[model samples]
Every structure is written in C-alpha cells, then in structure tokens.
Target: MSGFARSVVVGGSGAVGGMFAELLREAGSRTLVVDLVPPRERRDAFLCGDVTAPGPELAAALRDADLVLLAVHEEVALEAVAPVTRLLRRGALLADTLSVRTAMAAELAARAPGVQHVGLNPMFAPAAGMTGRPVAAVVTRDGPGVAALLRLVENGGGRPVRLSAEEHDRTVAATQALTHAAILSFGLALARLGVDAGTLKETAPPPHQVLLALLARVLGGSPEVYGDIQRSNPRAASARRALAEALGSFAEAAGDGPDPAEGLDGVFEELRRFMGPELTASQDHCQELFRTEHRTDHEGEKDR
Candidate 1:
C-alpha cells in the first residue's frame, strides 16, 4: 500500500544498472529486469530481450511498470531511450542512470513532458559502496515521482546530490572524467612495466598507497568506458593537461630541489583561508595513520 507495485529496469545487469534493480526491489517494487544478461536477484523475471525492440515483449514489460530505470551505458543510451519512450505509461517515472544529462534530459522533456525524468550517477564502485555512498540525481520535476527517487537512495544508504542537467554533467566531467584519466594513465604505465605489484607494495611509500587506491577502480572499469568519458566531455582534455603540467612540476622538484610543496603554497593558503588553522588537522590525522604505521614497522623489524 505504501510503495509502488511495479517497476522495471532495462540493461540492469552491469554494476550501476544492477544497483538500480536492487534498490527498487528493496523499496517494495515488484521489479522486472530486461537485459541480455540476467540481473542479480531483484528481478521477478530476467527477460533476455533487447528492450530496444519495439515488439510486444518490450511494450508488455513496460506497459504495467510504474517506474523504469534506464540503466544502459552511454554509447547506446540514446537508442535505448528511443524505444522505451513508446512503452512508458502516462506519468511513469523514467529514472535514467546516465552521465551526460543535457541530451538525455532534453529528449525526455520533449517526448514525455511531466513524466518524471531523473538522471542518476552512483558515486562509488558497486563492489564496496552499496551500503553507504553518494548518488547524484538531476530531476526534471519536484513531485511524488522525484520523492520516490529520493527514497530509493535513502533506502539504499546513499546520500543524494540533486542538481540540474547542466550542473550534473559539468561536475561529472571534472570529478569522474578528469580524475579517472589521471589515475588510469599512471595505472596503465605501471601495467606495461609489468612489475610485481605485491613486491612493490611492500616498499611503496604513503603517497603510493593513495595512488593505488585511486587507480584500483579506474583500472577495473572498461577502458573503452574511460576513453568515451574522457573524450565526450569537452573540459576533460584541458583538465588532464593542467594536471599533467602540475605533475611535471612535481617531477622537476623531485630531481632538482623546488622543495616538494613549493607550488602548493597557493593551495595550502586557500585551504587555510577556508578551514583556518584547522586545516592542519589532516596533518595530525595523516601522521596518526601513516606515521604510526611506520613506527610499528620499525618495531616489527627490531623484533625480527
């Protein structure tokens, strides 16, 4: 009585896609999944048909759906939207899991006015983030349908960052595209060198762990997916170039002595401006985490 009885997710087999199905099921929606590959357990039926098909199978699956999550990847997202448009019922909420929001939102607005279009970006890896993380939402309307989405995130233990389409894509370009490119570049080089990562880990300094943690994900996702994200966003290339320049400065400083944090003066200055002297709190926290660990390492060696 409290929740919607019917919901369906298309292409809900992959990580983020499967998450959509999982959340909806936990929300008490009797969900159906349409994908070539079967989704994890939320689905009532794992129908192996192209939802892009205009045939009765796609239509029938969508006809009774109160909500539909378009969870396909970006490359063929437009094509996925086209057929689903014909099948969604009047006032059905079409929550799309997508990165670029401009075209997707525009197409939905033009075709399905007031039909509850929401763009979603799950800001964590599926392996570890289901219990608690941030999920971004770009809403076309602020009503019951949007509330359903808000509830979906809350129930899934995710914080929601609501934004407009323009803001959504812009943030994704900087946060995801640019950062992913940076880590992936380093990770790919490391892979090519073919060093024993486990052996290297034993000698890796504190900063290397940070790089490993960041690159761990960038290397796991489809390389083609990363390539598309970096190329699709116009601002991504410039950002990556700027990051490259900054890294080059760090390299030069390491060999010759610009004293490590030389260029970081402005950064620290701005950060101190915001956090006052409390910015040094991280200095203590880092010392506790890394410095203490090293102290323990020395003790271990002495014991040996």
Candidate 2:
C-alpha cells in the first residue's frame, strides 16, 4: 500500500490508543476512533461502542478501513481477536499496541491466520510525542501494510526497531520490568526509612535526588499499567529475582560479612565491558541532564 487511506483505532479512548489515533491522523490517514466511553475530544473522529460487542457503526468503520489499530488493554485486546478478525476486510492490516507482545502475537497468528498483522509498543508516553522515542515493531506477517506502518512511525519522528515477539518480550523484561521494580523498590525503601519528600529534596545527594525524581515520575502514572507490565511479562519474575540478588549482595558488602568487594569489582567490570564505547557518552549525557535539572529546580524556587 502507498499509505493507509483510512484507519480505525479500536480502543481509542485510552492514552496509548488515543496517541496512535493522533499519529495516524497526523500522517494523513482518515482516522476513526471507536471506544466504549465518549471521546474526551475530537468528537468528529470518534464512535462510541464496545468493539467486542458488534454493532453497525463498528462494522461500517472496519469495512472500509485500510489499517486497524487494536489499542486496548492487553486482556481486552486478546478478547477482541475474534470480533476484530471477523470484521476486518481482506487485505486490511491489523496492528496492536500492547506493551507485552508474545501472547498477543501468538494469539493473532493462531486466530487470525493469513492476516497481515504487526505488534507495536511505544516506549514513551503519548504526551511526550514520538520524536526521538523508541517504538518496537514485531511483524508477524510482513506485507506492504507493515511497511507503511513502519514508515508512519518514521514520519512521526519515532525510531522503529524490528524484533521478534520473543525478543521484544525478553528485552522489555529487562528494560521495563526490572527498571520499574528497582524504582518502586527504592520508593518503598524510602517509605520504610520514614523519608518524606521534603526531607529528600533538602538532604539527598545529586544521584539520590535523581532517583527520587524518577520514582516520583513512575508513581505519578497509572498503577494498573505498571502492574500489568510486571505481571504480563513471563521473564519479569527472573528480572525481579536478579534485582533482589543484587540488593542482597550490596547489603552483604555493607555489613559484617566476608569481603565480596572483589566480586563486586568483577561485576562492575562486566557492566563496564557491556557499556563499552557508550560509557563516556552516557556519562556526558547524565552530566548535561543533571545541569538542566538543577537549573529547572532553581527557576522553580525563584517562581515560588
């Protein structure tokens, strides 16, 4: 396909779906948003209905849609397979924006055979826009539709990374699962130590301050979304276990335990090797980030 002429977003009420709808519209597609709840805005492009429960409106939307984005929650997305597949016209592309890919990919392959499908996971919030953001694209069945979808991401300033369903889930287990676990654990530790936000701001070192800010950002988001990320990925348990083991080692090193400093040094060296050429660049980036954060904080104080 040259480009999608008409696109329908099945769960366009939610943040991710809404973002996908916006991006498709910006990419020059005539977008229609279908959701159970009334659209918050952009009424011109929205239809209120449950996708799983078929209706004429949804049927009409899917009949002419060149691209259909399943942008609902993971569980809902899975349930929508039968209904969506039934409604999707031949040659129309079906793509999903689920955070976890393995299960959805398998379901789509098994239930919607011969359908050109793609799995998408946007690594950042929609409000942040796609500019410089990473997007994981798992092409279950490659075709012109898949190419157009990838091109759409590129047009909207997203970096599209192609990965298998398994690869995508495994990577997210480390990147999303482990990272969120560590940040949430940090927040919990602060609470256990009776550290208040004001006290943290007043006394924490720069690194600690940076962590506190990250924890705050994580907590500010939907708890259900984070919970789903932790629960849905099969490898998440291993990542959590690894985090616990590392924390235990750190505690042992700090306590009256045998000297594990050599072991720690070895681990540090391994990480440095993994980072390799990126280490210096990463450090520079962090320094700049810190400077910008400090300036923003000082400006906020002046406003106060």
Candidate 3:
C-alpha cells in the first residue's frame, strides 16, 4: 500500500497528537480526530469522545480507520488499547506516541494479536517539527500499515530509527531520563544556593550558560510529560541511580581523597576512557556552540 487512506488520532488536541494529525492530512489521508476537546486547528472530520468509553460514532470511526494513533498518557493509552483495538479491523495499524514502549507492545499483543502496530516516540518537541530529527519506531507487528507510517515520517523529513520495544526503553533511559535528571539536578542546586538569575547571567561561563539553556527547555514544557518519561520507563530508575553514584564518586574524589588533584584527574581519565572516540567530536561541537553564543552576545552588546 502507498499509505493509509484513512487515519484517526485519539488525542489529536495535544501537541504530539496534533503533529501526527497534520502530517497525515498533508499526506492526503482522510484524517479524523477523536478527542475529549477540539483541536486548535479545526478539521473537516472530528469526533469528541473518550476512547476508554468509545461511543458508537467513535467506534465506527475507529473501525473505518486504516491507522489509529494514540497520543494520550501511558495509563489512558493502556486502558484504551483493548477497546480501541477491538474496533480496529485486522491489518489496520495501532500506533502510539508513548516514550516507553515495552508496556504498550505487551498490551497490543495481549489485546489485539492480529493488529499491525508500531510504537513511535519523537525525540524532540512537536513544535520543533520532524525535519532532520530522530523519531524512534518500534514495529511490534510489521505490515503494510507500519511501512506507510514510516514513509510519512520520512517524507516529512524525519529520521525514523528502527528499534525493538526493550531497546527503545533502554536507550531512552540514558538519552531522555538520565539527561533530564542531570539538567534538573543542576537547576535544583542553583535554586538551593539561591543564585540570582541576573547575576548568574552576567557572570556565568559558557558551560553554565549552556546548562541554563537546558534548564529553560525543561522548565518551559509540561512537567507531566517529563514525569512520564521518568516514571513510565522501567530503565529510568537504573539510569538515575547511575547518575547518583557518579555524583557521589566525584564528591568523594575531591573531598575524601588524600590528594584532591590526583583524585580528580583519575576520575576525569576514567570518564574520558568511557566516552571513547566520540568525546573529541562532542568537545569540538560544544566549542562551536560556545563560539556561536559568544558571537550572538557580542552582537547584542554592539546593538546596545
């Protein structure tokens, strides 16, 4: 099949859901949005209803759809799968935008064994657009519908990376869960120290400024989304524990060791070894970012 002829987004009012809905529409799919509330952009076909207690209208829509994408919370998605999949015709695709996929995969297997499904997680914010960004695709049951969805992502300039459900969860634990925890921990320390934002902005070095940028990103978004990333993934706790242990090691090295300088050097060396060849490339990339930031700041001063 070229692509899905009819697509339905269960929570098309939300960011992730809305993104998919727009993409599907642009691909010439007869897109229908079914949600508790209306989406920001009005669509020709829309159904206002809960997927958990799907009404006859909603059931008819689901049954007719070639693809049904769930963009709701983990609990809601899990709860709706049985009912939603029951309505979906065999060979129809069941997909989700959930960060954690292991549970969703299991749910689909148990609830709808014959349904062709995939678990997708957009690595970046929906507002950023899919262009040149990584979009994880966990094909639970591969079929024509799954291929169609992957093509849609690619056509929209997204990099659809194929991964298993468990693999996706493990990798994201490091990329999302651990990374967010580190940035948030830094923000928490700044707050605990009662550091004035203006003062920090004035005197903070490039690394501090970089961290502040990350802090801004985390703080600006919905806490519920970030919390789901941390809580839903089984591997997240292990990743966070690793972060805690590393911090303790650094503290012990500097404060408890006989020779602080030597201890710090050893820790740094170990880290560098762990990072391997990619560390140099990362350092160079970071330096380029710092240079760009410096140029922007200098230009602002010139304007002033």
Instruction: Enumerate residue pairs that collide in model 3.
Output: none
Worst 10 residues of 3 by lDDT: 295-304
Best by lDDT: 3
Q: Which prediction has more favorable TM-score, 2 or 3?
A: 3
Model 2: runs farther than 4 Å from truth? 254-256, 261-263, 295-304
* Ten-residue stretch with the least lDDT total in model 2: 295-304
TM-score of every prediction relative to native: 0.78, 0.90, 0.91
| Candidate 2 residue pairs in backbone clash | none
lDDT of each: 0.74, 0.85, 0.88
Model 3 agreement with the true structure over 1-304: per-residue lDDT tens digits: 2288988998999889999998998888999998888987796378899999898998898999899999998899999998998888878999999989889888888888788888889999998989999999999999988998999999999999999999999999999999999999999999999879989989977778889999998999889878988988999999999999999888888887555767788887898999999998987777677778776442232211
Residue-wise C-alpha lDDT for candidate 2, range 1-304, written one tens digit per residue: 3298999998888888888887888778899998888668774388888777768978888888999898988888898888888888899999999888889877887898888999999988888888999999999999989999999888889999999999998999999999999999988988899868897799865678789899989989989979988999999999999999988877675564587556566667778999999999987776666667675442232211
